[model samples]
Structure formats: C-alpha cells, structure tokens
Target chain A: MTINPKAKLEETQDGTVVYNFDPLIVKSHYEIDYVHSYAQDSEFFKALGRQELMGSKCKKCGYTYGTPRGHCMECGSETEWYKLPNEGKIHAFTTCYFGGEAFLNETPFHLVLVEFEGVDSLFMSRIIGVDTEDLYVGMPIRAKFRRNLKLNPTDVYFVPKA
Target chain B: MKNKGQDVYMISGGVTKFTKASPEADFRLRTKKAFDYALNDVGMTLKDIDGSVASYFSDHFQRQLMSGIMAQDYLGLTPKPSKRVEGGGATGGLSFQAGVEEVASGRMNTCVVYGFETMSHVNTWKGNEFIALASDTNFDYPIGGFYTGYYAMMATRHMHEFGTTVEQLAKVSVKNHGNALHNPYAQSPMKITVEDVRKSPMVSYPLTRLDVCAMSDGAAVAVLANEEKAFELCDNPVLIKGIGTGTDTMRLSDRPHGKVILLPNETEADYKNLKYPGVHSFRAGRSAAKEAYQSAGITDPLEELDIVELHDAYTSSEIQTYEDLGLCKYGEGGHFVEEGKADLKGKVAVNPSGGLLACGHPVGATGIMQAVFMFWQLQRTIKKHFKDDALQISNAKRGLIHSHAGTGTYVTATIMEAVK
Candidate 1:
C-alpha cells in the first residue's frame, strides 16, 4: 500500500494529509538549512582547501593534537595552529554497513582512526580505495584533499600512501 | 551531593512494556502509566510526591522543547519543584541520582524520577541521524561517523589488543537475549545461539544485527525517599547505598592516556602494559565504579556484587564494561565471558533483566528500569514483579546499576543494598 503526504484531505484544504484514521496519524513535515559557523575552528576547515591538515598545539605544554582544538586539554592554555604531516598510520578502523540518512547511500564504507608520529592523539576520517579485509593496524596512510572545498570535514580524507 | 549519612531508599517504582513502536501512546501517557503504577504499588497518591526529576534523551524525538515539563503537568505534579536532566543515554541514571540528592539533602521527603523516550516519531535512519547529532557534530558526523561505527572501532581495537574473539561477543547476545524470555516487559526475547548471532545480517563488521539493541519506546518511574519517609511509604524499601557519576572528554581521541584509576583490589601492576583507557576501555566507567565502591564499602566487586545491570547498548560493550567495573582484569574480559563468569549461575550475574540487547534501549528509561528491576531483585520480590523466578539470582544481597552515554563521555554507577 502506497501512502502520499500531499494527498489533500477532503475534509480540509489547509495543506493537511492523514495517513491513518483509527489513531488519526497526520503527516507533518519539517526541514531546515542551518547557517552554521565553525567559529575559532574555521581555520582548520579552511586549511583543508590548501591541502594542509591543521592541528592545534599547546603553547605551554608543547602537546600536539591530531584534530582541531582551541585550547590545551592538558595545561588549559590557548593553542596555536600547527601544520600536520600529510602521511600517518591507521590506529584502528571498522566497516560501517549501515549509517545515518546523510551517508546511507554510501553504506559499507571504512572509517579509520589515523595516528601521526608526533601527534598525541588520533584523527577520525574515512579511508577510501581500500578493501575492508585488506585494512589493518599500523597501515601507512596519507591525507587526500578534494580539489573543490566546501569547508566541511569530508573535504579531507585518508588513502593508502603506497 | 554526598549522602552525608542520610540514608536513601527506592520505596516504589513502575515501568511500561518496551516495544519498537507505540504510535497510540505519547511520552506523557507512558509516564502517567508508570507513575500511576508506582503510586499504586505503595498505596500512595500524587500528594506523596514532593518533587520530581524528569529524564529524556532528545527533544528531536518528542519534537517538543519542554517535554519534561509537559509530562510533569500531565502527571499532576504541578506546583512542585521539577527539572529535566539529560546525559544522553545516562539521563535516567542521572535523574535517579538527582532524586536521591533531593531526599538525602532533607529537602524533600519523597522525590519521583520519571523517564521516557518516543523514538518512533521519526524514521529509523533519521533517528540515527538524531542520535549521531550527539556526537561531535563538526568532526565525527561529517565523516560518516555513525554511532555504531564508533563502537565497532572500539570493538576492533579490543580484538586487536586483547585478542577478544567474535564468538566471545556473540556469547553476550545469546546470554542476554535468553534471559529476556522470562522478562514480560522485554522487547526482544529469543532462544538464539552463537551461530544464529553470527549469521544475522551484519550492521558493522563483527557486529551483526542481533548484536545491536532496538530503539524502544517506554517509560519508567522510581519513587525515592529518606529512611523515615521510606518506612512510612512501604515495607522492604531497597536502600540506596551509594551513587557516583564521572565524565571524560566528549571526543574519544581527545582523552589522555592517564593512569588507571585502581579499585580496592587492583594495583598499578594489573595494567602495566595497558595504555590506560585507549579506545579499548571505558575510563569514566572505572572512575564511577571506584567512587561507588568506596561509599558502599565494597572491596572485591567480582565477589561482593551479586548482580549488575549495566549499559549494554551493544554486545561488545558488556565485555568491555566487565573489565571497567573490575569484574575481571583489564585484558581478560574476553576470557571472563568465555569462562561463563558473568552467567546467571556464575560468580556475578550481569544484565539478568536482558539488558539493552534484549529488553531494548529506551535511552532515558533504560537506567531507571535497571534500578526498578534491582529494587525488585534485592527485595526478593522478583517472583512478584516478574511473575516467574527464571531471571532471579538466589540470595541476591546487593546489585549495581550502571548508565553510560556517548563514547563513555558521561557514566553513572548506583549501588543498591537489600534491607535484610
């Protein structure tokens, strides 16, 4: 049985549709296009457009992060933008056979936690062009950037280096 | 707030049957049913409730900003102090502790903690998106970081670090779902085997569909009071021995490799090579357990705790939590499950109520349901509440209820003792 939301209820002309009667199921639609801001982390996303991964470094503790951070988590000091190497190693990964609505069409994808040599933490990203069974820990990987950027995290991903 | 030597007890409580969808009922109706059942269980009325703490996970599910207040008004808890508490999946556990604070502080004689979730309002995929919104939306969500993928990554790391086998993870599903057979309120009751679990369609690698919990709709109500008020309300009030809450970095990668917070029986040597709280373990859970055990005067949790109802949003998490709660050595969780140490007849019975795997993960109602089950278990009234003795542990003296959220960002542990 097919149900249509814009069926136009005969009893009403107020742009309403009923899916059921016993419980009176009504179809209500909601959608939004948020004008989001990256704020202080704007530089990190913008850097992806330049083929550069920008990590944050604590000025006081000399601690480094693989991902963006505005302040030092350990010393509570303000951080500065630091350039991250293009190549890194896969710390861990998993194959997601199911995902959210945004990524449902791209199901059965690989999500990896990439670790850097000098970085203190791992960075989450997708590993393209790699078979799930072929993926393993300590695998050599390099960051890949999209030619056209949208200031989104997906603009930067990881691929096998060699 | 500390207990401050003022004892608290869960005098009465009630829960609605969990299901995949309940289009006929909304959160308000569910809470009213549970609240009425709780009040009637003690032969009390709405007048007995001095205040309340409402718990639910997401406004996206209910599509109402102040759904808690709406439920409060529906319950006729008007003119009373009430506030909403949310810690993702730990909302129920946090609300229970909030009510405990109300009674223990001598502020209110009786406090009600009610929790519910109405996830059926959205499509399942959209519901996943709503839950994924709880992640670091900027970082994780953009890279196709589905919630299960995070857990799947952790499970993979656990497998790599400790050689935890897929069969071991499947054992958890088999055990938990089997226990749900006697639980009349459970959503998924199955007599499945490890092979059946392995054969189920894979959601993520190594995690079959059966290994995951269903999004459920239900509500639970727990009435708490100080000792004097507890006695006046009902007989066999279960004592709230201790309650503890802990948190970690919102992002898993941001967590530092800090030293393990040792329990009474554990030492630095137990985790000498273990890179403390890597993706393989839950550090906040251990912190919560450490504090809860201290006030409860518990030394050896594996032996001291008769039953533990924990957050098993996935089969693999149950094994990892066993290690965090000090039920086994950090890297020996797989062996613990393989040896049947967490079985119904084992040293400790974990998730005898079927946990989230079988009973379903109603988010906000899950932890309160755990406490309600523990309330009945400790009072030796499992026969009455469950209508069968299949899920009961013989001579259960004490039980621990755990609630967790995010990637172990927020965790709570509440210890309950029976009044012998």
Candidate 2:
C-alpha cells in the first residue's frame, strides 16, 4: 500500500502542506529538524500483535544476539541473521524508584534480563502484565508484545508469558 | 642452574591515542594498533600470537558487532582461538587474567589480550542506559539508578563509614591532576587544586564533576609468552607474577549491606559513618595484590616496590585501594594522600603515568594500559623528573599494576621486574 504524502499532511492557511508521518518512521528517514532522539525498533516491539519474537544468532559459534548484524561476538565468523525461539527464562531483574523530567514513567516498574534457551547472554525488557511482587529468579516466561497505551499506536511493550 | 619463577609474563604491549572518541579509529582500528604495537614491541609478528581475548559488552559504542573478530581480522590472524570477556571497567584486567591462564596452562605459548571500547561515541542517555546494563536492569534502571548513581552511592557510603571527608576525596582529584601535568598522553592535563575540586559542579552527592573519570576511547594490548620465549623477545619483560579475580553480588541491595544516603544536607559525620561501614570489597584488590606480592617474593610493598599503577576509576576508588592494596593501614588512605606519601616523588610513586583519572578509562584497555605505563616506567620509556638525585627511586626494579571492575567487584594485579 502506498502512503500518500499529502494525505497525512495538514493543510495550512497559506496552502503549504504540513505532513504528519509517524514520529517513528520520520526518525528513520529525514532528520527530525528539532525533536529529541528515539531508539531503533526491535523484535521485542514486533511481536505485540501475537506472533513470536526472534533475534539473529551466529551460525558458527551459536551465540544468539538482538538485532541482526554481520558478525558474531564469538568465533569471529561472519553471521547471517536468523529468527530465535522466543521462550526464555528470567535471569535477573530490578525496579526503578527515582523520576526525572525526561523519564516518562511514574513510581516503580519492573525491568528484567530474559535469558533465551541455549543462549548465554540475557535480553533486557520490561516485564508487564504481571504483579511485581510475584517475580522470582529462574522464573519461566515467554515473550508477548503488548500495545503501549501511552506511546504512539505502533509502540509495544514486552509482557511476560505465563 | 634451573631458574624458577611465577607462571605469567607479558611478552608484548600496545596502545592508541587516548581520546574521547575515535571516529577514524573505532574499537577495531584501535585494537589493531595495540595488537600490532604489542607484537612489534616484543620483536614478534602477528603470526606468532596463538590466541586472542577482549573486553566489550556489545558494539553499542560504535554500532558494530563481533568486536573480537573485527579485531582479529585487523591483525590478519585467522582460525586462532578468540573470545570476548565483558566485566565493565575491569574488562581489560580480566582479559589479562584469561591470557595468563592460556600461557600458563600450556594451551598456547603466545596469547594476545586486547581491551577496546569507544565509550564516548554513544549518546549520553543511551550511554547511561548501556552502562546501567551492569546493574539489575529491571529494578535499577526503572528506579533511576545509573552508573553515576552506583558510584555515587559508593562515594556516599564511603564518606559515612570511615569519616572520610569530601576534602580527602578532593585530594584525589588534585593529586591526579597534578600528576597528569607531566604525562603527555593524559586526557586532562591541567593542574587542579583541592579548592578547585570543591567548587566543581556535583554530579552525584559527594562526587563532583572532577571526581569521576571521563568516558574515554582507546585500545590496549598485551602478549603473554612462556618464560623462554619472553627472554628472547624483549630486554625488559614484565612478569605477570600473579593473577586473581572475584565477583560480589551485582545488585546494590544484594551487596552484603549499606543504605544509599540521598540527603547531603545531613552533617559530615553522618555521611562518613555511613559510606564504607565494614565494606570488604577492597579486600578483592588486596587479595589480588597479596598474591602478586607473594609470587614476586616481596615482603614489604611500602619500601620494596619501585612504582605502582592502580586502577583509580574514580577518586573514591583510588583512595579505597590505598587501604585494600596495603600501601597504607586501614582508614589511613586519606591521610596518606593528604601527606603526599603516594605522590610520584613521595615514598612510592602511584600512577606516575597519570592513571585512569587523567588518562581516561576505556574499559577493557584500562588494565592493560596500567600495565603499559608500568612497562614504560620500568624501561624508562617515560622520563621521571626528580628534584633531588638522592630522593630518586632508581631503575624501577619492580612495578605493580592493579585494576578493578565495577565498585571493586573484580580485580587483577600483576608484578613486574626490571632486569638489566
């Protein structure tokens, strides 16, 4: 489907069109001209609609990684990006307390290091849709993409799988 | 006659310009420089190295991946054993230990250890978020615990526990800046005074902007060789006499005990008593140094050592090390620095090469960089200006290098000797 450049634009009184492309897509293309920076979209944000989340892994060393790259951390071999199994266990976690002007969230929220099967390193994410007090070490969980109410429609949060 | 000595010795060493960030020289180029420099410094070639080790989290600093391989390819060394070890600030130090094991265990006669990080290349908030990766991601990040926060907490705790004054911490900044004046490679070479330090903007409670080491970009390399090979390679081969490392619980709350003091409005005495309170993390540095001392056959580090290069990642960390490394008695670190005992011309010259405080701590390169400074001092590659001929500590017969990971969690120490 073609995105109409004029359709997303707002007509001004002077007839100069002001386009309203999604901030996320706008960040990836032209310079924002004058807005704060943003993070690149990841697989963690891709699975919110109900499919599985996958990351690229090195074929030679079997080291799984987030966001596909051309090489591996181990074995120094050129790597091709591939989909990884989403099921992982909670390795470590923490909760935040202090708030600053830039910090968008309130009070305390859970952040976790999720370790996938057969991978040595952990994947970091916010463990939503679960009670914070109930979490523990080695908890078995799966990945779920959750729609973020506060962010744009495309924004997603990684919730824990039961 | 059979000569008996400890298992580890540095057969090669390398370095790159200490900068905030290297655009043309990323982690890969810097690693290659250090690697080639180390090999050539030891009169060897890339083909002579048998294994490779490095310190890097992810290539988040430069937006690259597989830093280890990227470095290995830079050397054109293929199919050799290569691995990456990530331990935050102690990255370089831990990689040295790994290299030592590789050579000591007879797995390889020559191993290359490299630490490369372009910490300044990333955005400030993103960099903060990346460093927070060391903390409990879920709990600490959401709670606003940053790398500065963790070190700040340590500074606050140290102040409370030992009656350590902010002036004492300022002494660390002043002394390091004074020493940097003589060092050509130091990132911040201007002289700073205690008054200057006190007036600097406070970053986290007791730690002023001057108190913390800047994020630096550089690479350091070391080549470990067996005893016989070492003898043939260099005139002054620094022996890696002993190597030891340990990890404390990563979580700040999980750490045995200590509360984070937020309000600086409290009295000075309140801060002192709360800072270090029986905290034993410095023991990690002492333990590593003790083993290094024992292996090098030294009885008194105070009188016997010629030079010392300590991992002063922060002013507070360097002060803590004075107690941990047994350079002074317990709770006497502040007094020692206040009296100029650890000054380059004092009883024992500490960080004559200006240390990480001024030279910049580029994560993995820090430990090896410490070793390189010691090697240069031992070889007289870096000139030492002495006022009195009699006061001069001549020949640098023995040198010590110490480095630690986050909040003193991991430590690596090595002893080197100058043989004419």
Candidate 3:
C-alpha cells in the first residue's frame, strides 16, 4: 500500500521532521479505445510505423493531449491530429509491489507520470528497460511504441529510454 | 469557552466489544447491539429516542440512501428524522456532530447516532473500493490510491521531511496496544513493540502492517439530548460544552503549499520562535483542539487536561495528536510516550480505553466512541490507574474529544464537562 499524497507533515524546532511518503508515477500506454479509434485513421497509424509519436491538439484551447480524442477535455471542442513533442519529463512515479490493471502486464511495473513539454496534463504509462528503484522526479524521457500482434502492427506503447 | 446556546448532552451511549469478525451479522444487527447497549446505559429504550442518525463509511455495507431509516426501523424507533452521515474513517466522530446538531438546534429533544460495519464478511477488494471513495475520485482514483497508499505517502513524506523514524511511529502502536491489553472491548489487544512494528511486513514504504488500524466488525452508538432534558433523563450526564469543525481542500495536489500545517508549536511563545521538526500534532487536529480548549476555558492543555481519547486510526495520527492536543511540546510526542506522560497513569492519560489502533475503527462510530471513553474516564468507571480525580486535578471539570475526516481534510473537536 502506498501513502496518500494528501498526508500531513510536521517539523520541530530541533530540526526533526515528520511526514508521510507517498510515491506515484504516471506512464504512457495505448488504451484500447485510443488504439481502436486511431486504428481506423490509417494516416495516424502510419506515423507510428516511422517511430513517430502523435497526439491531438484542441483548436479551441490550443491544448495538446496524447490520447486520440473526439473532443478536448478542457474546452470540449473537436480536436485534430497533430504530432506531439517526442520528449517528455517524468512528473511522478510509484513502485507497485502488488496488483496492476488487467490490461497492464502485471504487478511491480514502474508506473510513471509523463508530461509532454509545456502540456498542462500528463499521461500514465510503464517505465521500461531501467531499474524502477532508480526512477526519480524530473527524469528526462522519450516515447516509444511496442506493437501488439493481436492488434494492428502500427499499435505502439511508450517506453522510456535506458 | 462560555457554554454556547447549543445545549446538546449525551443522554445515552453504547459500543460493542470491537472484534475482528461478526459472521452473518449485517450493520442492522450490529447497530441494534450498540443502540440497545446505549439505551440501557441511560435507563431508556429505543422508543425514547426522538431522532436518529447513523454513520457508516460506505454504501456497500448498508447500501442505499435510506439505510439510516432501515436501521432505525429495525430498532423499532418511531417516525423521526432518521438520517445518515459518512466521513470515511472518521464517520463515527462525524456522527457525534450530527447528533449534537439535533439537540443544539432544538429541532429534536434527543438524537441517537449509530455506526457499524461488518467488514470481515465483505470482500476485501470491494471494501477497499469503498474506502478509496474518500479521496477525490477524479484525481486520486485513477492513480490506484487507497487508504494504504494515501497513508503510506504521508508516512513516507513524514519520514523524508522530518526524519521521523519508523520506530517513533511504531512506539504509538506499542503503547496503544499495551493500553488495549487492559481494554476488554479491544479487538487486537496483544502486546507489541517498536521492534515488532519495524519487523512487521510493509504495507507501504515506511509504514508497517501494525501501523494501520485493523479492519474489524463492530458498532458504536451515542444519544444526545438538550441540556435540561439530559440532566433530568440521565443521572451521570456528560454535558457537551464545545464543538469545532473545519474543512481543508479535498485534493492534495490542490494544496501546493501543503495545506497541512501542524498546530503552532505551543511550547514556543512565538510561532516562528519554535524550531521545525519537533514534537507536535498535525496542524489540522491542533486547530480543532485549540478551538475546543478555548471554548472550554483551557489555556494549558498539558497542565490542565486530564484524560484523552483521540483518533489513532494510524500510529502517526496518535503521535501527532500529542502535540496537537498540547499534551507536549514539539518533537516531544515520542518522548512523552517514552516518559509515560500520556500513559495510563501518566500526567494526562491518553486512550485509557484503548485507541482505534488497538480498539477498532467503525468509521462513523469513532467520534462518539472517543466520547464514550471520556465519559467512562470522567466518571472513574474504568478499573485503570488514572482515577477519576485526574480530571479534577486538571481542573477536572472538562474533557475533550477529537476526530477528523480523511487525512485531515475535515476535523471535529469537542469539549465535554461534568455538570454539577
């Protein structure tokens, strides 16, 4: 079990400190709906074949989001496909000793919060190819895609560089 | 604090022997046990209760908007304002506030608040889903955050920032468990040590299994009445003197500056004079305690307070309360425990009836359960070292009860006095 991010802390006059430690990480993953919706858009799938990451930018709010979407979350306006910043920064992450979402591989995956440069919101995914223990806040990372045999060959999952 | 016009007083209160399991028993039965225990405590029956409020943590156990009415009907209570209040693990304490409002507002002559849970019977995952509901769903839920994760983060942060050793947090468990050994109603009354806490399996980093409150099956009930009727209906009435409640932002991310500020170090004359990282209660709890103290005319909590029954839902919560309740100075909570100032026979007895760590947490029942402990302590009813005179020496005219909702977002602090 992890600590709640909202826990309280105290510091003493003698320099003793007390607080709760909660760590969580967000990573990038292709949610089924995201892959299914973009699979129909041949041009979007072609971008992944070239190892390029893509996103949708909302015209109404100028917001760029990772998940292929019909509408923008912020302004609720129709969004058009656009290439996203290839590089991102790790916002936060947590090491899971037990349990994982069904779609995720299994327990103990390094869940990372990744914020594309200059984006207000971040996406969650697994940090691959590195010892999760060494993961820290503000680690520079880039997106990669892994194709699933069951899905289209263009399907991709983001993995942080070693 | 002047006795406000809110004249709520406990006309009756009841609690079951907090246990790990009560198979086949639903909240309705558990609540009945507590209600009957309370009704008998006051020499009255359920029929006498003019209004009722039930506190439960999740809809899973009782299920539905009218579960309060369902539980009330099971008690054979007449048509009255049967309502429900939930505040995560602090549901019990929040229920006390609900009952207090009934009498304070003069809308009802008496109000009964009941809290119960049959956790052992429910699926653990489902139970967890309910507790996770306490957080801001939109932001926290997707992160797979729950009680363990939430508290673990806090524990981790506490260790990182304040250098608060895991052992100090464990000391709270050890001491409270020791106190629980004396409490017949406690669920896990076995003795524990700081070493035991350290060796225990980690739930989240820095927090061991012992540091968490046991998920148990139990029920607690309390009845509040107007001042005049309380004196007439009950022989040993514990008068409600002060009530204070506050709410902070719900999401941690929202409080970028970290909304949690430990109560101003009371040991230092100036807020800035005191050093950080000392013995102190979390700021939110101390705020509640300060409001209670001021209302009850208490200036020195360490010197003037008698027995205390606080929310120890986690070991750290209890340790922080020492500083919050002004029982000791900053960084002195650990020393206070080691020195026995908050022990059964110590200066200001804490959790003499055991705490949530040792006793059990039934969410809505917790706040009123603390009141019940204070009631017994004030009357010297317990066969413990801290005699009834402990309150007397501390000017013994008053007692304090503290409770909070989910990681200090909401707090309820109350002071009860022995009316002559």
Per-residue accuracy of model 2 over A43-116 as CA lDDT, tens digit each: 33344354545455677877666433356644678765456566776554544332222342443545554556
Off by over 4 Å in 1: A1-15, B1-5
Sort all candidates by DockQ, best to worst.
1, 3, 2
Query: What C-alpha lDDT do the candidate models reach, one value each?
Result: 0.90, 0.65, 0.65
lDDT tens string, model 1, A98-139?
Answer: 988889999999998888998988789999999989898889
Q: On a 0 to 100 scale, what is the lDDT of residue B343 in model 1?
A: 88
Winner on lDDT between 1 and 2 is 1
TM for candidate 2 is 0.68
C-alpha RMSD for every candidate: 4.4, 14.0, 14.1
Instruction: Summarize candidate 3's per-residue lDDT along A114-160 as a digit string, tens digits.
Output: 55775544554456666655765567887766553222422444456
What's the true lDDT of residue B323 in model 2?
70
Candidates ranked by TM-score, best first?
A: 1, 3, 2
Q: Specify the CAPRI tier of model 2.
A: incorrect
Leading candidate by DockQ: 1
Which of candidates 1 and 2 reaches a greater DockQ? Answer: 1
Q: Give a tens-digit lDDT track for model 1, residues B285-358.
A: 99899888988889999989999999999998999999989999888988898899888898899999999999
| Candidates 1 and 3 compared by TM-score, better number | 1
DockQ score of the complex predicted as candidate 1: 0.61
**Which pairs of residues collide in model 1?**
none
